[model samples]
Target: MSVISDVSIPPARTAAVSRRFYITAWRWHFYAGLYVAPFMLMLAVTGLIMLWTATISGRDGEKIYSVAPQASLAPVSAQAEAAFGEVAGQIVQYIAPRTAEQASLFRVNQGDASYMVAVDPYTAKALGHWDRRNGLYDLADSIHGTLLIGDVGDRLIEIAAGFGIVLVITGLYLWWPRDNSGFSSVLVPQLSAKGRQLWKSLHLSIGFYVSLILVVFLLSGLTWAGVWGEKFTQAWSTFPAEKWDNVPLSDLTHASLNYNGVKEVPWALEQTQMPASGSQAGISGTPEGQPVTLDAIITLARALGFDQRFQLGFPASETGVWSISRDTMSNDSANPLHDRIVHIDQYTGRILADVGFADYGLAGKAMAAGIAFHEGDMGLWNLVLVTAFCLAIIFLSVSGFVMWFKRRPRGATRLVAPTVSEPGPLWKTGAIVMLGVSLLFPLSGAVLVAVLLLDLLVIRHIAPLKKTLS
Candidate 1:
């Protein structure tokens, strides 16, 4: 038959098939909704709040430099002395200058600008703000991340992510076409101006297109759930680290030492060693004459092909350390835009650790790329795509519910229970086989087994309550 002629389904057969599909979809949808709807709603609301984040927060300030100045990447002890004077007593701490700097910046909290200064190591000139801005992005981040509810909010989101996976799986099963003829009906919407055509098209069409992305969104979200999920990813990704396997207790007591113009002092970083897990390593502070420059550092990092946006944290004190972390555009995780860390010594202006993209193992890179993709930072185009998908998900979920509620029958199915009858013993045997296969995903499998046991042993056998409930 021609593709167009294939559309001609008998009315009785079509209605019968539609009835079966609706019953199956409705049954699972009802159960899944009972289990997951609240969590899904929580995600939807949080997502919407995050969409407007760039407007609410303030930007953290950065150091501003002039072309006429050329300074050394030196330590900041001398600059601290000149800036604070002798009475400034006990260099307490220094702020790392936000520069490709060799200078250790310091803050005396002497007056109005208690917020640290990014001082020049050679000239002692004060630089700009060191903290990030608080803008709409921060507000959206907080809403998406913690709902302003702290730990409780995080836990709720984690649970929601877990529930989301189940919803997707059950939704697929419920949506699957039963026969070859049912394929078009399940996959596409009818164009004939019949009941709820556009609504049906919107729901089914969107869900079909976004199935893969939705799955990634749900799975990536689970990475934040807890230690269990963390370990699961670590294992799946095969992340390796042997250096932290052994630690000498004696190494903990001794503090590293540093020097002021006329005196020596103790510092924490000097005594500590980074674990061998491919962590970025760098010494703390710039040398007395060789100050690090922020612009220089950015150029260096870019040379390493980390042309993505980065945030530089200046050393807070003469004893403070400089740090740089690559920043991604958003929450998508599949893009490898931000998998880098850098540390530089503030005292001598030496590269402590510059972990490049190539330095990470296979799994680490995959994890990084996944994170980038999830954040919608793969590129500008993906950002638009993900935003569109998010809107589609929200719309589909609402429409699907509306369709179900509108067509639901008024009476209980109790009268048909006896006539419906149980599946044959062979069916039970097949269920056991299926349960065996499901056990690979331990958590989901255990839940399924428990559910099956409860249904068979309790729901089916408990006659009095079964009659009333059914």
Candidate 2:
């Protein structure tokens, strides 16, 4: 027998090991894409619809138009009154217009329902009113978040997002150019190629281009999921309400500030407890003998340099404070660094707690900035970039499905997944890395374990299933 080198494996063994690793990765990638592609397509389409609707027409017809910017504008109180007159409800929130020519939005509560009323600032005329949560934009957002099935859908989407990460990894591995293949093979699609080659080129190139953005979108969107997001990441990353000096705490959280069940509160503060309004626990900003009206709070907000677009959340109860917030979450300002939330006593109009972006923890600050970018709120460029990213996602999903269908045996009823081989040392290393990832994302981890069990106990044992899958 030929003497084997003590320091190195035989070339044949090395090639076999590499091939096994590739097959294993491809198998996992195929399964993940089989389930995740549809959801990814849904999210991308809905996200695109929401982005355009929010950017161009505004949510729920909140956008108002005027003939031109007037030299003088009506008082916010008059605008609030105009909105209430149109909606017939207790005014709960006021949104200042970003520009004089734009319309102001007032949120009104009528019985159990909440409505958004648009009033032209220049004319103080009620432009329109609609149910805040029942609008087209909100519908699209709900679909994106929960697939219109609530918590179950949220969990499913979270699993899909987790698999999405796996899909990207495996895709990158398969797309890795070898030998003399260079930038053109990796970056450019071979449109001139026929059949499977054409599909593979388009799928790989587009998937590679959008991989980073897909990760960002999935991570940010995961921040809102019921499990990994709400119970794990958000629970720890939330702004600490205890940072308030000697302030009376409320039983409720900053989640209470979410008007009409919409996520209006900043991401970092959403779970933080709200400071109560009693005990004279704040600095006085109330004018002498002047009630804290919408006008007064608007004036105070302006005085504090919340000049452009800012939101005022009316006191929820007798002890609740009027919440004045100016943050990138609401697209109030372009800079996340300037995010601020001020609570004025409903009874005393005193500034209770003033939390700024600088006060947030490292994670909190990152989330605040991440949310702004995720929403495409930075500028037109941001919108265009996200739009392209969304389109790429849809194209990738569709291309993946097309490639799968074309590769399957004609008229086959079973799923034609890649064949799996026994794990080599390299395969085991990949498994270890995935285990770490699963630990970080609990829901994802659970699903991964389930898949492993199914493969070992069910898929591998059943004759038809094994034949179909492999």
Candidate 3:
């Protein structure tokens, strides 16, 4: 019952206009496809790998628990001792806790790959050993993150994100319904045009509906990948201190907003001997101070009720701090966990600057939130939405290619359009200049320019002698 729904057009004119708009969209899709397909394929493949990681991890339907159901999790100190003793006489260097449950595991690098030794916190009983890269989960994650090529692969992912944004914009332009005749063609699949028109509608409609999701997914992903990744991290570092203003705790507005060199302070500034100083050459050992074992730090942290799965960083200087950053994955607003930085005195083993989780700025909180969003950890609803979006992308890419293939030339007859009469010299020159600017943002634009060159110089000129070329 829509106003335009009943409108009709002359059959001949309708056919002519519909074909024109369809070709324009097809050509735009063609140019963009040739430029971005390689990157898209890589992203698609890597995305598949990442999705498979979640599927494989959950395949068994068994709950992965760090703590034993029967036995209580022992004190952090005792758990560390048991784990160390179990792995003793094995040339061990450092042992760290992954969870509060003594049954939790720690990573050990023996040779080529890391090993996980699961231990009971109460008695330090060795549960089992697991290879770091034995399963598809590890392989999928590695490929998704680094493409198995490390930093170089990461750069490619970032570039893909940038171009993906362009592809989205251009696709919107090409999909824009020009007139009433093409409205049905743009919105709904054609059941009567064999399977070809049906696919065209499927691809166009899906692209239109999922446009926002695709853009957000790509941008958020870009925020994690390249030089933008550094920016995103720095931006999130300010989140902690921002929330303190409204909280009931002590005032934090006067605290330094800058985090530069904040973690560099010595644990015992005005006290006795410092921990060992870090070497200039590499990550050196602590100076000639009493060594703080993982057990001791874990004991202190647990006594303070720091949640499990937290990461512990050793002091940098001999007088350095032993920083224990509490895990934020499980924190709710009411019982928030502060990313802690405990300046433990190396000599007296006393706690110095015990900056709790509330010490971070607004940037830090935002960063944590951003990471949670990317990992599909925001909530079950978010995970479901992201999964749906990813599947939509797979469909869009495949359907787009299929539509292109179906419209391709056959035998000695190509569906060739006449040359678009060149615009005035100034207009053509100005348009190219504007396109050059677009190229700066999306490398795909440059690829489009190259394809135009091939089309104008080769395809168009050769179209007249199609039989010879064929």
Per-candidate TM-score against the hidden true structure? 0.60, 0.94, 0.63
Question: Which candidate leads the pack in TM-score?
Answer: 2
Give the whole-model CA lDDT for all candidates, comma-separated.
0.48, 0.83, 0.49
The candidate that achieves the highest lDDT relative to the unseen native structure: 2
Candidate 3 residue-wise lDDT, 211-282, digit = tens: 887776665555446444534343344323322222122222212111111111111111112222222211
Judged by lDDT against the true structure, how good is candidate 3? 0.49
CA displacement after TM-score superposition, residue 243 of candidate 2 (Å): 1.1
State the lDDT at 198 in candidate 2.
97
Where does model 2 exceed 4 Å of error? 1-7, 421-426
List residue ranges in candidate 1 displaced over 4 A.
Answer: 1-26, 55-156, 173-186, 193-201, 235-308, 315-320, 329-338, 410-470
lDDT of 2 by residue, 257-356 (tens): 7654457678889999998987778876768468877778888888888887788888888778899998877778778898999998887777889999
Model 3 misplaced regions, further than 4 Å: 1-28, 41-45, 51-67, 81-102, 111-113, 133-135, 181-193, 227-296, 299-305, 313-321, 326-367, 411-470
